[model samples]
Target: MTQKSPVESLIQLSAFDPVSREDPHARMKPLREQCPVWRDETAKTWVVSRYADVRAIVSDNTLWRNGINAEEGSFARLLVNQEKLDLPPGERQSILTMDDPDHARIRTPLAKALYARVAKARPKIDAIVKETLDGVAGKKSFDLIEDVAIPIPIITIARILGVDDARLGEFRHWSEGAILALNPVRTPAETAHMEASNAALDAYFTELMAERRAKPQDDLVSDMVALQAAGAPLSDIELKINLLALLIGGNLTTTDLIGNGVRLLLLHPAEREKLAANAALAPQAVEEILRYEGPVDITGRVLSGERELGGCPMHKGQSVMVVLRSANRDPDIFERPDAFDITRKAVPHMSFGGGTHICIGAPLARMEGIAFFSVFFQRFPTLKLVDEAPQWRTLPFFRGLERLMVEV
Candidate 1:
């Protein structure tokens, strides 16, 4: 047996390992320095890390496609649906996975509806943030991720989607299942867990769509059903899949965003104080948290045809995982890419991704972030982390803490 060189060892590291998941920056630093477009032979997928390369990879669809759409796929597959399992019969593809005309059809109206929700959600979101923050108040310690971060957006999105408030807990469980299913590598137990959760989510959203069509409500599901009834290019399956997407995508990322912000603020006490003194800097702090360490670690596109990207040749049907976390830290774009500075006047990172598939819940998430951070600090000015080293989950596509315990 031959000993692998250090560079070879780093290059061969598994994306789902504890080391990569815990500190991906360290595993990816040498790659960014030596192989900006690193290819994993075992996975047969290219990993692009540099900022320029990630951006180019996102827009150059002529060289890459979205979603691994298969004949055995469903009418309600997510934008990054790579699951192979039992699904209902219907022709479906999410706007996140589609290109051009197909994507435009669903995205245009969806954007309109989402923006309306955001426009009216500011006051309500503030209330939700305050209510969630209140739960952690007058307490010596609490799990920030569970008590504060998760509930804010989960409750907000539940209200927006018209799901019974009692089911908010169920939403988190299902969303976790949905996200865990996205892990490229899953154990047999995880597979069963995902299947069960997927079945429940699909049924729940479909039933909600039915109820909305029969009796229109002021909620988002009702609005989407109305659009579909009015001959919008959306089908019932598309509507349902997007609803699941919104529920999981909207709440999960925002939860991590809050967690990331709180963790960073706690780690950097001075910067936390800066935001505490000035409420207006909450938004900037949130943005910095996103750039420094976003929730989504990686996203990819399917190659459309042979083309040159990031000075590398690629063929059709190949996929490239653009590591957004790494891209955000590129020295070329950010002044001190690694530093977590609330006052940094930096260009936006690929936190919400790029191109047509940018995250739809960005505005709501921002509103939630600003409100949560501003209110949280105001309530607990001297909040501190209960545990300095919180464990992080090893999800291939997401970056978030398992538990962030803090105290006042």
Candidate 2:
């Protein structure tokens, strides 16, 4: 086997290199073609980039969700060793991190709550999208990340959980901190902020739970609390953990996904025009956007036992990084994969993932995407980027614009 290049070795360590963040597709394309299951030497883990390999690994239920210590170098060791002090790394993971029966026991009820809330929120989601846009009505230039993308999902999720609207700004701050906490290289200040955010979150949710129990509204939290009282009750810890998951998942992923879509639309005028002309294509465009440049690039999984993926030896307990973004663009799976086409016959993409751990919020995300693009085009027909080159954030796990300066 050939010796790995410096870049490949650096990737292993999960360093936040500017080149990859600015244009990872350029760097990843050649690597994925040459090595489907390549290990990052510095990061000490395997990264699978091909569509077939990534899909197979993700589909296999035997794999455990693994490898949360994202900070690079010795700082990572500090986090792992001090695991007792860590917040529960919540996603779909809060309840389903364990194997089999236990996983199902915890997840079943939570999934029910999520599905019910999504159905109830559909009619009003469109209005929420318009209301967000209205906040910046007549503005010449605005930061899409701050003014629009972040607020929409946070407020929607907050409202669904019956969280106080007055605390919207606080929710945004803590959510951003929690999301940034996913990064390994957080400085002392960032780490402090993250810890404070988690502490505040615990306290806030604790109060909300008390309030819900007292008032007993028809919101999701109230519903869950009521269910517990009648017969099946989620534990206090479980409830708090699940609330964190819903808030973060509901807000962060959709925010980045929406930002990515708007950024792509601006870059590719031809595709944007096609969507503007036919609003019905908004849903397809969202899928294409997800395939072409989804917000989340990769996620980690632990091998349950010795298995060979793409002919590479994957041992039990070894970490595997499923490169969803790279897999979506694999030339083998997608012809002319680089091109963004809304009307192309549906090609299955792993944007929401697959199998047991598939995203639970996919329905809500789709609604938000369609609503945002539909109204975005209609509201700001002549919107154009003030700075054609968007300042993309240097986040390895998350992909999004730091700021989208647009003139309406």
Candidate 3:
């Protein structure tokens, strides 16, 4: 057996690697320190790891999400290709995979409607969280991911989308399967499941859209229908595609936020005690958790024109993978970056990416997190982890646990 060079080892490092997946900071710290803008020849992409570099790349408007210069087989190209597969020919891509003009056209109305929905849904979100916790009240132990984390967001988003309680389970199933679309290297079975879920969602939403068109209800679907009827510049296809995006985005990532926050609090009892002592600390603790262990891992961009980043000269049409988790832990920006301190002053984290393409669902995710944590510890004062070792999911570009078992 031959020992690989340091650069080779770093090049081989991937989110899918079990060791790296479980503890990416260990692998990423070396990469950030040694080569902040390292190019992975195998993936034909530049990997930006340092906080400053990632911020610069994301903040630059010249960088494109439409994959104009993205190398073949690169993560950017994979995302673009997947979007192509999901949409019909000649249709605009979802805001997640498109540049401005089209991206803004679709995003503005959706963002407006979503913000309004989330703003008014706070009380409902709290009620949902309390009701969800109430569901597991008598149980001595339960999987936090399934019992608490999963239901709150799913139920909330379902109601927002006009999906009734009767179909919450089906809505959840589609969301779980459809989220596989984010995994660039999904298996054939996973791919099939994703497609099936997409198909089911398409059919369901199509019917619902027609119904909403005929009779507008007081929900997101109806809100969108009203927006379109009032000439909001969104087409039917874009509306459906983005609705699907909101559904998947709103559920899984928020689920992980709750799950990861609980795990973090459990692991750091002192921090938990502080939060338990002061409910006002819940919002700050949520931010700390987002910084320390965010759900999404990497967001990338394709250079629209030739540009230099992190002292590295890059060409037109080249892709740059911004490691958000790595940036969150960059020592240059974060003091004691590796330590989990819930009371740390709120520093903006790259967990929700940055700039124009920042995750639009972020406010709502934060709301869900604050709502969950505000009452969770108070309700289950005796909560503790069943397993200290977390079982992280293997899905690339996503950092979430497969399960978080706990005793209350």
Candidate 4:
């Protein structure tokens, strides 16, 4: 019998594979221990698995997100799509796909506006959570994903963005479709759904912007419009695209965070009791949930210059796939990493990517998690998981349940 090489072994653990998707840690454990860094010739990329290695790669600014220097047909180039170079700057990329000057230019104003909005949004967030839970009250059995996790973030973010309650159903549908952007491998139907959502968002924002200009209101959309009018360095298209990005980013991940956190609490009744006994533990529990099963599993970077990582020689234009989940679970970083302990004091998790490109909406997501968990168990003390073996979504680079059925 022939033994599979490390590269072959790594390649087989494709994110699209069901077995890998269901329990990636089982496949990642061996690689993290033995082959921390291995170049997959098939994908023409370097896969980094260990905690230290993943941290170094993400923190290094030398590796860029834009893939401007990437070689043709390489993973980096494929990510940015060099073919779109001729398009307008705003038309070509979102803040996630930009580097340095362009990234800062757009990120600055957006972050200022978003952080300001989120800082004052605590009251609104609590109200939204209460309202959502109110809807699920009196139900004997319901899907945590559909009934609770999904609605809270969508409503909270929509309110933040100045979107009206009347159009919330549409916003939810568009967000569901737009989240397909996170999936690298998409079927034809998925691609179409994403495109349609993008188009709808563009049109809606365009009209909304015009309205805000005509009569500015006291919401995020109006604040952004005022900033642009005050000479912020943002194009119309850039503003629209980033707003769409925020809409999706603000909700989808938070939804998963709530779902995953609740599931963890259900799976470990002792932990739930601990949290219920002391609401102060909610914040720590949220961090543990992020470390254990974050919504995002992987993030990538393209090398701008030749460099070596974890004893492996890498070249300019090569891509590095950072396995965030693996890094969070590395035994070297967290004691008994696989075990979920809200009280554990350890290094910060890589669920939110590090460095310049760290998630801007992380605070908002964290707030939502804390708010949801603090109230959820208290509201439904008898809540219990109806399905022990809940199904996880097959989308690569993301970790979320398709449905978390529960009874109250």
TM-scores, in order shown? 0.87, 0.90, 0.93, 0.94
In model 2, the Cα lDDT at residue 391 comes to 82
lDDT of 2 by residue, 42-68 (tens): 666678878998889888887766333
lDDT of 1 by residue, 1-408 (tens): 022212343223334666776677876676776778765544556677889989987766454344553112311123443453344222344565666666778788888888897889888888888788777677899888888777787788878888877777887677667756456568988878777877888898888888888998888888888887778887777777677767667767888899988898889988988998999998899899898878887777777667776567876666677878888988988887878899987557888877777788888888888888776787888778888886776655677888988878
Per-residue alpha-carbon lDDT of model 4 for 14-112, expressed as tens digits?
A: 557666776888778877887888777777778888999899988887678886566666666665756778986566888887887888899999999
For each candidate, the alpha-carbon lDDT, in order, equals 0.74, 0.75, 0.83, 0.83
Q: What is the lDDT of candidate 3?
A: 0.83
Candidate 1 C-alpha error for residue 132, in Å: 1.2
What is candidate 3's lDDT per residue for 1-408, written digit by digit as tens? 022224443333455777678687777777777777877767778888889888988888767888644777775676555545655422645788778777788888998999999888888889999899999999989998888888888788888889867877898888878888777778999999999999999898998899999988888999999988999987777788888888777678998899989999998999999999899999999999999999887888998888777667888878888889889998888899989998899668999988889899998999999998898998999998998989888777677888999987
Which candidate ranks first by TM-score, i.e. highest?
A: 4
TM-score of 3: 0.93
Q: After superposition, how far is residue 396 of candidate 4 from its true place, in Å?
A: 0.8
lDDT of 4: 0.83
